[model samples]
Target chain A: MSGRLFHYNTLGTLMKGGFDGAFTFEEVLKNGGIGIGTVDHLDGELVILDHHGYRFDVTGQIHEVHLEDTTPYAAVIDFIPENKTTLNEKINKEILEEKMLGQFSSKNVFQAVKLHGRFSKIKCRSVQKQEKPYPDLVDVARDQAEFTAEDVTGTLVGIYTPALFGTISASGFHLHFISDDHHFGGHVLAFEINEPLITWQTIDTVEQKFPVGDPTFMKTDFDYSSVLEDIAEAE
Target chain B: MSGRLFHYNTLGTLMKGGFDGAFTFEEVLKNGGIGIGTVDHLDGELVILDHHGYRFDVTGQIHEVHLEDTTPYAAVIDFIPENKTTLNEKINKEILEEKMLGQFSSKNVFQAVKLHGRFSKIKCRSVQKQEKPYPDLVDVARDQAEFTAEDVTGTLVGIYTPALFGTISASGFHLHFISDDHHFGGHVLAFEINEPLITWQTIDTVEQKFPVGDPTFMKTDFDYSSVLEDIAEAE
Candidate 1:
């Protein structure tokens, strides 16, 4: 089966102010897809699937975003899983990347990556929204709150883009987490898994959807050099 | 009002056997959008507006694709005209681009471009379906059928993307022409407008939907560099 990855905005433009989103949260979910993104203006981390959107703020407080709410950046795909491979050996994050990328012939297209089962350990972060006269993405990232969870049973939802994607899409493995119990999760910073169930589908196509609310997006002289550097450092 | 420029597939990918499409013709028209694409496997050209899809083939024969038909690549956006201006002076293609781009605050985002009225001259092209052993896009383009219409009353449906988009999108300007009588149209190759009615809207968001076919897409070594080159050269 083929897949399409729907991205709300490019990471580069969002650095300037794409955070002021154009569509409502409900409108985005009507497609009934799965993926990850941040709330408008970087207020929190978001995880969506099956028409429900969960937001975990910098304080780690889990809140369900209403349909009327908007997001600065978001992504989704009508996921129909075609694989269920259970790894037999323990794996670290780096090795996991190697094993997965090795399966694909190329690294340029989008990949729908999902992992189920318990994690030995995981580290994640979430950012708080900035006030008017918003700061650069790097600055916002500098103050992002970090959290850690151990021996948690949950699922990981994310997308993998080619490194060349750079600012348009977040490069490398970008993921968000939500526990099975629906108690803990956020943007993934680090993780360790032992023989977890892995399911991935390479997306044949993608749509880069931009936000409509940011008026200053076009006028700003965003130095992408620094913006990209910050994104890489954070990753 | 806000607009979105929906694209079917990346220009680069379409060059490498992306002809196998996923969504049905009616599904792509549900958004009440206007744009263009090709039938699955490059069978015919497509133009959609007002919940209707118009198909034109290499023979310049116009037909309507059934709802069950699929498109390898297609794009559309809810057309809510935010600007309408009548150009009373004789104009060429270059000056039209100048006038349209000049009205927008920035050329970094997608713009839904539509020109209505009688065209002094217009040239277009369309390709036929390939056999089992599908060749490269540039090869298909080599044998594309070309058509030109003079003094036709119709509308031009298209979009202008940022140059940085390169292969991810066809940068500069991309358009398709369909006569008012629905008897003439194809992928726009060249055109000259004299005192036509022009309308444009800055798309606030976009969603790229992929067709649910082609199993070997992820495993194929698509030469994006060449594919991109072909798109750029053709554009």
Candidate 2:
């Protein structure tokens, strides 16, 4: 049987400014080989590739994530790709998304995708660590640091969620990038791919684990109606 | 560790008239001891208590569900109750719901509930088997057989889903009843409890398994935006 996509907490909790980390990196890696998320206090961008976790800080510095580091939200899978294809032609994000959509047998299921190759240009963003009494995600996003890297070879780990689950997780594609040199990386805002090898797995099963014992998670009344709008603004 | 709530398919798929059964009841029971669902061809109301599956057909006949019986949608759990209480006073469905809500530590997580005791009255409905070209659930529900039993003892099996996951499962409470004598049962529409024992579990983890290999499930494009409205109209 294929391994399920393991999800920690939820975007809904994060949107409500519940950014404290509850699950450790070591525990997250035990569930999957690759994933993307943010560290404690909404610190920077997290990318897990080849079973190694890396953090891309707001100051454009990359650091190897410690096993004890914690995350507020993450979606990871064992990543046994059912389909593998090479895209020799140059393509932008829109074209790549269209191709991926074409490959899906069902548009309503979760999908895990990985792309490894050269990229002519990749624009990314990372958030600075926040202090107590955290503001909502939309507010924190306003001060996000944006950067661009040109002519970088890297791997992009992406998770696609159907529209039905938009509130629980980010709707559509959420991708993070990390260069082979372990220097350039962040949440992918836009990218131009060049001859990348793409591997994707159609995820039919998902294990969503919530921070039940966390006081913040247990006390707050999450307003899901505004979640999609908040995620749109924050992302 | 608490067992995760196991869910099969989505309410969105059923709303779109995809009624073919995919997972076997035997497979569903392996993941949980108690649950609620419908049998193949949208046959009738299905209830599983004490690891035994039973069907309340439209003709007011209850039958033992065989191992080979299939299901298109189901939500089941190993049912380890975290809290147990008894309501000795008479209470209607609305009041019972309010009390259950009071027991919830968080309004955003899934919950499993079981009620066993005497009841003054119970109003319920069961759908007849459908043909190949299955009509949408709303239409099917319109022609459902409604029945009521007064002064009886039975069990009410229920599952509570948060608003965030409304499209995946029923938003609020979805309950089914089965008399202790096995002579009466159906999807509960209204009920009056008399001194019942209530046991509920706060669900922090969920395992959602989709029918990836089913042709109908793979071909249908689920419209989740109107699922809430459809579910409201249907049930």
Candidate 3:
């Protein structure tokens, strides 16, 4: 659940100097559209994921401009366990895995790909109101009959960086996988959720570190190779 | 030589989740060591490459350090062409090619490896520097033709951003490729020459971009794929 997905522009060599052929860092700002798709369990409640659209420099003859493909994270579903693992325990683990992997999401958008159901593809709109707009995932998991939040007390689900959202802890996201099946799938649902990708100057909040002893953490001394390898091996 | 050298500890099985006999991120940081070699051709007189001294964490251990490796950039005597190509132009092209390859140099200080001559196996310093006493590097490439300060424009060799240094620029480097020789079997010499990597926090710099008015400049509003193919074919 708390896992990451790295999406390198596979279609790079076919382009200009590569992925950003004519789209230099400067050009990207002038005319680029980040493509994003989200299936919100809740209607219009914070678009669980939002791609702060792309920019364009000039208009075409018909006044139409093409937006760049900019979706950062894609929901990749691997087979989920079919056995009867306690609902809460399964949910917590799902959240945890997704959060761990979410760290690898684009630095600009602290987005985490959430997984809902033990099935093939996740549909766009099938979640409850209580879980809308960033669910109270931790609190909800506490009510499950077979599991408790204590299972992941010190484990890190996400990291917090102050530079991203001003004084508001913007970047790092933690995973809180919760399980529930009877409501929708009847096949225990898994939620991999985390903080939205916050950008600089866009939000009024300042960056802040996560609470002490969180597993999803980043520090100057922390070596990144091991983490990279861990994620690499999982894939 | 600006190229870096790195090695793995076990060479295998580090990526197997590292949880149950898997290599964990915590272990990698504890043992990783990185060495940076700076070259000389990129330096200018009175233009010191501001190697910010090593920085430490609260525990009083060196968390990060910087160093320099200097080598010559002159072409191998045998490789010097009777043809009209300039040595400077050839060296510049090779260096640019390496950058395009995305070759960044960073080996963990704890798990440090010995520095070798540019791209060759020739070792430079005897004792590998430790990570605890973080230190900055100053490389010097000697015995070459002299040039006036005006002739010594700094090239953007590298860019670095650490929590402490913020954003720093590097220049000191000389990349020269040599053909085989009877005496010292010539391999690629990422040789360091007399130059220094400098910082960007300054005023009155000489760096300039090619203007759009230049006849060589080309602009187009097309897909990146088409443009890239055309450039490659033109070259």
Q: Largest lDDT belongs to which candidate? A: 2
- The DockQ-based CAPRI class assigned to model 1 is acceptable
After superposition, the stretches of candidate 3 with alpha carbons farther than 4 Å from their true spots are A1-114, A117-235, B1-235
For residues A164-218, write the lDDT of model 2, one tens digit per residue: 7888888888899999998888988899977778989889899998888787877
Question: Model 3: per-residue lDDT, tens digit, A1-235?
Answer: 1222211111111111111112222222232112211111211101111222211111100111134432211111121212121224333434544443343223322232333334222111121223322322222223322211221111111222222121112123322222231111110223322332222111111111111121121111332223222322211
Fraction of native contacts (fnat) of each candidate: 0.43, 0.70, 0.00
Candidate 2 lDDT over residue span B1-235, tens digit each: 2448999887777877778899998898887678888888889998989888888999989998888989888888889888888876899888888888887767778889999888899998999898877888888998999999999999999898888788778888989899999999989999997767899898889998888889777767666677779998886
Of the pair 2 and 3, which is ahead by DockQ? 2
The residue-level lDDT of candidate 2 at B81 comes to: 80
Query: Candidate 3 chain A: minimum summed lDDT over ten consecutive residues — where?
Result: A10-19
lDDT of 3 by residue, B174-231 (tens): 2211112111111112333222221211011111111122111112111222222222
Q: What is the TM-score of each candidate against the true structure?
A: 0.75, 0.97, 0.21
Calculate the i-RMS of every candidate, to one decimal place: 3.7, 2.0, 16.6
A1-235 in candidate 1: lDDT tens per residue? 4676777767776665556655688777875467788776678889886668998899988888899998777778777776567778888777777787886435656778888879999888988877777777767777889999899998888888864355576777888899888778998888899987888887765766654445566555455545557677655
* Chain B TM-score (model 1 vs. true structure): 0.93
CAPRI class assigned to model 2: medium
